[model samples]
Target: MTSAQPSGEIFELQADPEVVDKAALEGQLPGSPLSMHRVAKGHFRVVVSGLRTDAMLRYRFRVHRKDLGRWIQVSDPFAWQLDASRQRWSTRAIGLEDATRKKARPLPRRPTFDQLVIYELCPREVVPKATRYADLVTAPTGAQPRFGSIFRAITRRIRSGYYDQLGVTALELMPILAQGWRRATPQGVGRPFESPTERPPWGYQAMSWYAVNGDYGTAAELVELIDAAHARGLAVLADVSLEHGYGGKENGLVTDLWPRWRVPRPKNRWGLLELDLAAPGAFPFVVGGLRRLLVDLGFDGLRLDWTEKVPPKTWKRVVAEVRRFAPEAILISENPTLPLITEAGFDGTWDFFFHWEAPLLLRRVYRNWDGLAKRLVSTQRKLVENLEGRAYPPHGAKRVAGIDPAKGPPVVRYLESHDLPRVARRRVRWQHGGGHLMDVDGDGKTPDWLNHGSQATSRLGATLLATLPGAILLFQGQEHGADDELIWAHDPLESRRDAKTFGHYQRLLKLRARLPVLRQNDLRVLLSDDKRHVLAYSRGEDPARGDDDRIVVVLNFAPQAVRRLRIPMPSPGRWRDLLGGKTYPCGKELTLHLPLAGSLLLQKLGKRQTLGKRQTLGKRQTLGKRQTRAKTKDCEPARYARHASKPVSTSR
Candidate 1:
C-alpha cells in the first residue's frame, strides 16, 4: 500500500509491525508466519489489515513503533478488549463470583458515534438467507465459504484503519436466527439446527427470538465477538422481530414447556407457529422470552423487523419491559411506515425512500435538467410539508413506513437491506423508465442498470445521505461502489472479493465526519428538479450563523451536458469541492460548471464578516458591557417605550 500521510504527501519514517495473533478457533485464521517487510522508502503507516475476533475470542498483538510516539489505537473491531496487561487484548468471561471479585473495575464502554462508522452491509452479492442457529459451513450456492471463516484475514485490513477510509459506522448484522438451517452445517460444530427442523431464510417469521442461532455462536462466543468489536470501537445491532414469532422450532424452554401459549400458523412462509402479539394470556410468555434474549444478549439495540405488523401496545410494553431490566437498551423498528419515532421512544428509523427513490429521480438529468430539478423540489417539499401536523404512529405502526422521529433522533437512512432485492438486479425500476441499455455487464457496450449513471450516483448518494436530516447509513459494500444490491443472505460487507470499491467510501465518510453542519437538522432545498438531473440542497444549524455553518450539495446526473449552475456561496471565503478535495474561490454568487454525473459538497470557510466592520465582541468587553448596561443605561425603560412602535421579533 502506498503510505500517504494525512497531509497527502508520502509518509516519512517507519514503524515496526503491530501484530495481534491471540485468536483461537477451529478453522480460524490459523496462525500465519510473521513476515517482516521493510516499508518502501517514504511510506509511513504499514497497514497489517484484517484482524478477526468473535464472542469470547482472545487476541494478542504486540506493538513496537520505532519513534515511540504516543500511538492512538482506533478500530471498530469486534467487542473484545485489552486485558489487564493493557498490551494484551482479550475477551473475558463474566461470572457472578468473578464479576464481584473485579467489582472495583468495570469493562470499558463500547464505541459510540463519535469514534466509529456504522454500516448496513448488503448481502445480495452473496446468497440471500436469514441467519441460522447453526454454523454457516456452506454458502447458499453450496460453495465452501473460505475467507468467511478467516476473521483475522478479513478484519486485519479493518484493524489497520483502511475501512475508516471507507465510510462506515458500525456494521449492522442481519438476523442470524438460525433455528433450523443446520442441515447445511456439519455436526459437532456449533449447531443452530442440531436435530434438524423447518425454517425460513428471513428470520422475521420468528420461532424463538430469545435464542441466538446456535449456528451464529454460543452465549460465551457472542461475548467474545462483542468484546472484540469494542476493542475496535465498533458496536453491533441485531435484527429482532418483536411483532411476531415462529412456533415450529422454538426455544428449548419455550416450545417444550410453554407450547400452549403460542398460536400455530402452518400457512405462512415459515409455516411455523407464531406468537399472538395481541392475544390474551400470551403477553407474559412473549415478554418473558424477549426480556431473557435481549436484556442479557449484550447487544446495542434491536433492529425490530416488520415492526409495522406488530401491535403498538405490545411494542410499547416490550420497550417498557426492556428498560426495566436495562435502561440503556434501545429498540428501532424496521421500515417504519408511520411518523418516525423520536424523543423518549425509538432511537431512529431507516430512510429507505431516500436511497431507493433518489437514484431513479437523479437519473432524470439524462434529459431535462430543469424538469428534473422541479420534480425533485416537488418530491422533497411534499415530504417536508406532509410531515407537518401529522401525528406519529404508535411504535408498532412506525415499524413499517421507516420514518423515525424527524425532529429528535437521527433517522437511519438506507438504500438496501435483506428484504429488498439487490438494487443492481432490480426487476423493474418503477414507472420512471430504465432502458434495456442499462444492463451494463451483460457483455454489451451500453451501461448496465447496476453500473449506469445510477452506479456513479450511488457514490454521490452517500454524500447526500450523510448530509441529510438523519443518522447516516450505508449498506456494507455500497461505500465501495459494489455493483451488487442487498439480497437476503449471509456475508454482505466484504462478502465477495472486491476491495477497491471501499476506496471511495473512505473519502466520503471523512468528509461527513469532518463537517458538522452536514449533521445538523437545519435544511433548505436551494435546487430540486428531475428533468435536468440536478438536485441542490443546503444544510446548516442556523442561517444567521450559517454563513460558514452551511454546506451546499449539488448533484448532476447528466452524463454529457456540462451543466452550469448558479449556486449559493455558503460563506465568502474559498469553496472547496469535498468530493474531489478541490477548492474554488467565491462570494455572494457562486457558479458551477459541473462535469457529467458530477456532484459537489461545497464548504466555504466562514469569513469574520460583520456589519460595517463592527468589532468582534471581545470576551471581556462584551460581557462587561452587558453587566454595566443593566445598571448604567440611563432611562433604559423609557428608551424601550419610545421604540414600542418599532417592536419586532429579532429573528429577522
Candidate 2:
C-alpha cells in the first residue's frame, strides 16, 4: 500500500506490535521494520510478501516528520478498521473470509419518496444496553432479561401489531460510525452506558469513516439488524457526517493525512476539522467511505448531516459516486437551503423553515387569523413552486429536474428532532410560562395533563405534523409524548412513555395511512380567522376522486370553545367527521362547534340527499345504529340541517 504524507521525512510500517515493543525495551531506534521506499516526492510504499491471508494484523506508521523532531504514530488513511478500544491511531486487519462470512442481504424494496413516514431514533436511547448490533435485534428468551435486543423487541412489537400501528414506513438512525469519545473509567476501559458527564455525547464526532462504533456492536451485528429491518419491510437510513471529521487534536487521518486542508474553519461550530473536498485524495476517500456504508453495510439511504458547508462540485461528485453504486438508495440532506441542495442529487432536504414557522402558527404567537391565513397560503404556494422545479432566485441555481409537483412535496416535515427541544417538553414549558413543568405531585408522579395543558397542545401539533403535505418524521419518544428532553449519553426511563400520547400518535398515523389524499401535495387554505382562532385547509383534488376523498382539516387554537362557526364548504354534500363518524348536510357552508385546542378532519362523503318538507324526517336518523342528528337555530339560513354534534370536541 502507498500513501502521500507531505511532511513525511521517514516512514516505516510497524506491522508486528511485539517487534515494536521489543525495540522500545532496547531504548534504541526501532530498526529493520517493514521499510517503506519513497515512491514519489511525498508518496511512500511497502509490500509485505508471503503474509497469511487469514491472519488478523495490527499495524501503524512510525512517521518521522521533517517539521517535528519526534516520530508521530499514524494509522493507515484507508484502513477499514480503526479500533479505538485498543487506543487511538490503532488499525486492525481481518481476513477476507471473516469479513465476508455474513453476507448482507440484498437491498429491500423501499417506499417511494412521496410515501415515506420516517421515524428517527438513537440506537443507544431505543435500547439502553444496545452496545452491539445484535443487542438491537436480538429477541429476548425466557432465560434472558427484557430489553435484550432492539431488533428482537421491534420484531415482536411489529408481529404483535405495535410498530405497524404507528404507520411509519422508514427508520432514520443517528450517526453510528466510529465516534471519537468512549467511556473511560478509573478501572481503565470505557463503557457506553456511563453518565452523560462521564462519556462523550452522541457519535457526531467521527473517528473513522469506514469503521462502525464497536460500542454499538460489530459490523456483522449491524448487518443483521439491517436484514431484520428489511425483512420486516422497513427502510433504514443512516445519518452520516461528511462535512468534517474528528476535531481537537484527534490523531486520525483527518488530522494526520492531509495537514494543509485539515485546518479548522472558523465557521465550523462543531469544533471539527473541515475536510477540503476539493483537495486531492479527499473526495475519493469521502466518496469511497460513503460507498462502503451503502454497498457493504447495506443501509437503505443516508441522511447527510450539515451538507450546506460542502461545496456544490464536491456534492455533485459524491452523489454521483453514491448513485453509481446504489442508485435506489435515498439521499436526504440536512441543509436548510433547499431546491439548491435538491438540485445537487438529494431526494429531499429538512424543512427547518417550515418547522420553525409551524410552532408559531400553533401557539398563535402572531395573534392574527388573517395574517396567519395569508402566511399559511403563501408558504404552501412557495413550497408547491419549489417542488415543481422552481429555484429560488437568490440561489442562482437552475430548477431541479425530474421534479413532478403532482407527486407531492419533496421535504421531510417534523415538529421535533434531535436538534430541537422535544415537542412535549416545549409544550410543557410554554404552558407553564417557561417554567419547569415536570414537577411531580404528592403521589411522586407528574400528572399527564398538567394545568398548563401540554397534552392537548402537543396533540394539536401532532395532527398538523402528520396531516401536512410532506414526508413525515417523528423523533424518538415524540410518539409516546415523552416530556423529557433527549439527553444523548443517558438512558431514558421507562416511565417516560405515556399510553395516551402513544394512542394519540397511533390514531394520527392510522388516519394518515387511511387517507391517501393526505399524502398529496394539493393544499389549499379554505379559512383562517384570528378572532375565532380557527384555521381550515383542504388536501387532495376533487378531480381525482369525484366524491369527497379530499380531506378538510379545521383547527381551533383558542382557549375557549367556538360556537356556531361557519366554515365554507367545497361542495354542498354530506361532510363526515372521520374521527366521530358524524355527518352534516351543507349547502354553501356548514356551522361547526370546536372546543379549545381542537381539530376536525372532515371528508366529503357524497352528494347531499334532499327530502320533501311534507314528508318530515325523524329528528334523529340512525346510520349503522349510531345516532346522527340535524339541529337548526333561528337566524341561521333555512337550508340542509348541519349536525350539531361536534366531532372534534372529543377529549384526546
Candidate 3:
C-alpha cells in the first residue's frame, strides 16, 4: 500500500485474529504474518504469499500518524470487498478465486446502436412496497424479516413479457452498487439518514465500489438478473457514478484510501468528494472498480453518470480500460459530450436538448416554428459534424446533437428521464391550465381525448419520439404515462399506471420496431410552417432511389385540424398510412388533413403494391389496347377504365 505522510513512521499489516486462526487451522498460511517494508518515503509494501482464497478473511493496516504518537487501524482502501455486517468497515476476502473461476456467462446478443429502445427503471421502485429491500418489515412474530429482491421482481416482469410487450431492447438499471443509506424496514422507512437527513431512493451515492448493495441482493442475485434480462433479449446497462465518491459519514474510499486527493466542496446533494484524476493510484483504482462491474459482473454496458465533472483524459482512460476488459460492452455518458467523449469510444450520450426542446415545440409552449426549425437544422448539422469527426466548442454548445436521423445518432433521445420532470406531470399541468385542450369539434366542453389520463398527449409525444432517428430512452412508468414527479425520495411502487397510456406507448414502440427507416439517420424536413404549427419530415435512403422504402411523418402541434395542407411529395403515386392503413394518391404534392396533436406516418407504395381502387387502376393501365377496346366495345365502358380516368380523392 502506498500512502503520503511525513518521514520516520512504521506501517504494519494486521490480519483479523479469527481469520489468522482459521487460516492456521486450515493449513493455508504460516502462523507469523509478514511485516511491512518501506518501499519509498511514506510508502510501504508487504509480500504475503500463499494466502487462502477460498475463505473470507479480514485485515487492516496499523500505521503511525505524522505526529507519531499512537498507531491507527485503518481498512485497506483497495480492498476488493468490505464486510458490512458490522458498524465499521472491515476488509473481507469474498472468495476471489471462486468468483473468477465460475463459468463466465456469455452476454446476450445486443441490439444494434440505432435499434436500441432503452427502458430506464430503478429496480427498487418497480416492485411491491412490502417486497422492496428498503421496505422490508419485521414479521408479526417479530423474529424474522421479509423483503423484496430486485432479482426476483425483474425476473417476474421478464417472465410476464412486460418489457417484451413494450418492445424494450435494453434495460438501463439505476445503481446497484453499495450505496450510502442504510436499508430501513417498513416501520423505519420514513426515518432519514443522520448526516443527510434524507435518503435518495436512487442509489447514486455509492459508498463501496467493489461490494454489491446488500439491500439490492447478493452479487450472485445481481448476476441472475443480468442473465435473465439477457435471456429475454434485453441488454442491461448499469448506471455508474465515477465522477465522485460518497462523503459525510458514508465516505468509504475517500476517507480511507485517498483522503489527501479528495476535493473540497460537494459536487452534488449526496455530499460526494470529487477525486483527483491526476493523483497517483486514482486512475487504476477507478479502472479496477469498472473492471469489477463489467468483467466480474457481466453487464452489457455502463452509463457513466455526471461525466462532465470528470477530466476528459481520465474519462478516456477509464473508457479505454473498460473496453480492454470487455470489448463488446457499450459505453454511454449521461451528458452529450459527443465527438469529445465519442472520440474515447463512447457510442452515444443522452440528448437532453431534445428532451427539453421537443416538449416546448410539441406542446406549443414555444410556437416560433422558424426558431424551432433553425434549431432542428443546426442540431442535425452538428450531429453529422460530430459523427464525421469535426471539432466543436465546449459545454452547453449548440453544436451538440439532439434527435436526428444518422447511421448512429450521436445522442439518445427521450421525452422524459430521471433527471427531468415527468412528462405526465407536464401534460397534466398543461391540460388543467388552459393550454389548448385539443377539442377537435370545438364543443367548448372537456373532450374525451383530455380525460383518458393524458393518453392523447402521450401518444403525440411518443409518436414524435419513436419516429425520430436515435436510440430512444423511456423512464420508469413512462410507458403508462405516470404523473408522479420522480423526486429523489419518491417510491416508484406507488406510481399509478394508466392502461390507455400504456397501450399507446406499446403501439408506438412496436411501430418503431417494425419500421427500419425510423432507426436510420437519413432525414429531410419536407415542411415546417409556423402559422399552421405543422412540421413534416421524411426518413429513408438517399432521395435518388425512387423505390427505396421511405416514410413521411407529419406532426400537427396546433389544437385544430389543418385541412387541405399541401405537403411536397417525393415522387408519390400512392402512399399508405402505416398507422391508420388509409392510402392516398399524389402527384407532386399531397393534400392532407391532420387532426390536432395528431401524427401521420406515410409510406410510399410501389405501383404493384397499391391497394383497393389504386390496384384496379394499375391493372387497367397494364392491359393492351386491343383487349381494352374489345372489352370496352362490348361493355360500353370498363369499370377499371372509368376508375382510372377519375381524379383520386384526397379525403381521409
Per-residue lDDT of candidate 1, residues 1-652 (tens digit): 1122343311122221232211111111234322223444312332222333222323322222333333222110122121211111222222222211221111255433333345653222222233232233322211222212122222443455544446554656565442333221111112343221233344443344444443333344444454455455565666665535444331221332233445553334334455565554466655654554444545665667656655565566777877887565445666545432432256666654444445544444132111212322333333332222122342123433443344423456555444433333324332211122232122334442432434455555555556665466665556555554333234444444344335555666676677766666566666655445566777775556556756788876555554346655444445556767755544344555666556778765546422111111222222223232111111112111111233222110
Q: For residues 510-575, could you state the per-residue lDDT of candidate 3 as single tens digits?
A: 878888888777777787676677777788876577544888888877767887678887664567
Lowest summed lDDT window (length 10), candidate 2: 20-29
lDDT of 3 at 212: 65
- Comparison by TM-score, 1 against 2, better one: 2
lDDT on C-alpha atoms for all candidate structures? 0.42, 0.58, 0.59
On the 0 to 100 scale, the lDDT of residue 197 in model 3 is 18
Better of 1 and 3 by lDDT: 3
Evaluated at residue 438, the lDDT of candidate 2 is 30
Identify the leading candidate in terms of TM-score. 2
